[model samples]
Target: MKSLRNLLLGAGILLLGSCNQAPVSAPAEPAPVDKAAIVLENIMTRASVRSFTAEPVSRETLQTIVRAGLQAPSAMNKQDWEVRVVDSQDKINAICDIMKKANPNAQDRFPDKNSFGNAAALIFIANEVSDQPGAFSAVDAALLAENIVLAAHAMDLGACIQAGPLRSMESAEAQAWLKSLGFSENYQPMLVIPIGHPDQEVTAGQRDASKAKFVE
Candidate 1:
């Protein structure tokens, strides 16, 4: 019996010796993803879509886009910006009416009577006047608008940064409109963006890269 046990032990030792190997290393973490390239591609593909479908962006999607805007970098991180999302068709139509009155040429320029080009919603970014010198509240609002635009694009929505809305909102009727919408006197509109499902695809033209300079 002791001899049999020794034989079995020798056999097991031989099997282990034949199969002996260094611990197998886990597969190298899949090569790191090129996240930077993906981000750059997204930026490159984004275009200003002036025409949009009637499909309305849901509140949840808008909240996500606004959250991205809220994360945008601001001067001193003061974030002196107020965003008003006008989804009310009546208010949007009123703004269009104001635009027509403000710019008689709007109709001539745009194919549609509505100068807004039938956007599903209007996103207004107002710069709250900051007391800090060189606070650059307008710049902060501009950054916020950029973030909103990018976020909208990422979500398969189209957005265009329009200065026309603010211009139209300057009239007495527009002021009344703004007041009705609850914007304070200090909340001066800096940018008005219209976002919705894109009705048409826009392609980017070749950029004029000659004007750029790089310094070490």
Candidate 2:
């Protein structure tokens, strides 16, 4: 019995000696990402701004925003979009007048009361209306508009997507205005986006999972 016990203890010691451990692995570090760059997942999380400060947006910055807008995808790669940057105070006031006259009730609905109010610049998206089958140009123009808004927010600028300015003109008036503003007569205004420094901070709306549904 004593010999058997000693043999068992020796076997246990030998088993323990054979069970050696490998080296421990250190955790891998994550790669750094640019904080300012727009990520697709968070793109819709940004806010739309209407109010703006008296501070002006520089021409260089405006160009950057427009360039970003132009990067949006268009059907057939036509990229058939034209942008008009209205920086003149007089033209802005004129646009406001047109809005007021066109929509008499706009004063009550849009009480802030002006196109490009205190806005450093207004971005007008246009496309050749005759070139599309049915409002395709306008649809392309809208895509560009949304891109401009996202780019504006990413660049720390405030932007307001407005429908008032575009609705004020009839076909004739729109064509005339387009021609007068140096755009081809065939091009029609699709969106009027006002860009400037934000006077008040805008908080984005909370994500509503129910608002978006996926289908298999």
Candidate 3:
């Protein structure tokens, strides 16, 4: 009985040693992702939104959009762009009045007479025209405008780009208003973006990639 008990203890010790010597397995690898496809989808799904709800956009979100706009590339890396955010109803109305005077039939041409669809906020993109060579200023401003609109879309906010309100800036009243808003004389307003909660849904139009020819 003593010999059997000793044999049993030896077997138990061997089993414990075997358990401690268990092998380690490597971690599973993550699945590969198609980043380009995701980006293309985001761009394709973006649409121009005209109607908007009364809900206002937060200052933090606006800042984020502005940051994205500033990240846009410019000719010779000039980055000569400025953004003005207008949230006051009185100022928006005053601008709209100026627009009406500039083009009395603007309402017939544009869906919203306000030129901003009465959005909660209007972002005006301006550029230092004199600093750019030829049309580079407009091109740079356009790139920034695209960045702003895309960023807004990514944040689930509705935005529309319009150059209609730019006509108002030609008037003395509008120029005075812009001056009061701290815009410099050399800065020219290129685009106006209205941001808010979307009141309508817009579908993406079909694109014909075949229009471009590959020489290679």
lDDT of each: 0.82, 0.76, 0.81
Output the number of the TM-score-best candidate.
1
CA lDDT, candidate 1, residue 141? 88
Residue ranges of candidate 2 with Cα displaced over 4 Å: 1-31, 34-42, 102-105, 108-113, 131-135, 171-178, 206-208, 211-216
Mark the regions of model 3 whose C-alpha exceeds 4 Å error after superposition.
1-34, 108-113, 131-135
Steric clash pairs (candidate 2): none
Q: In model 2, what is the error at residue 33, expressed in angstroms? A: 1.5
Model 2 lDDT vs. the true structure? 0.76
Scored against the true structure, residue 115 in model 1 reaches a CA lDDT of 62
Error of 3 at 178 (Å): 2.3
TM-score per candidate, in order?
0.79, 0.71, 0.77
Give the per-residue lDDT of model 3 (tens digit) for 31-77: 78898987787788889887777788888889999899899999889
lDDT of 1 by residue, 18-101 (tens): 789667798877888899997787788888987877888898898899889989999889888889898877888887787678
**Clash list (residue pairs), candidate 3:** none
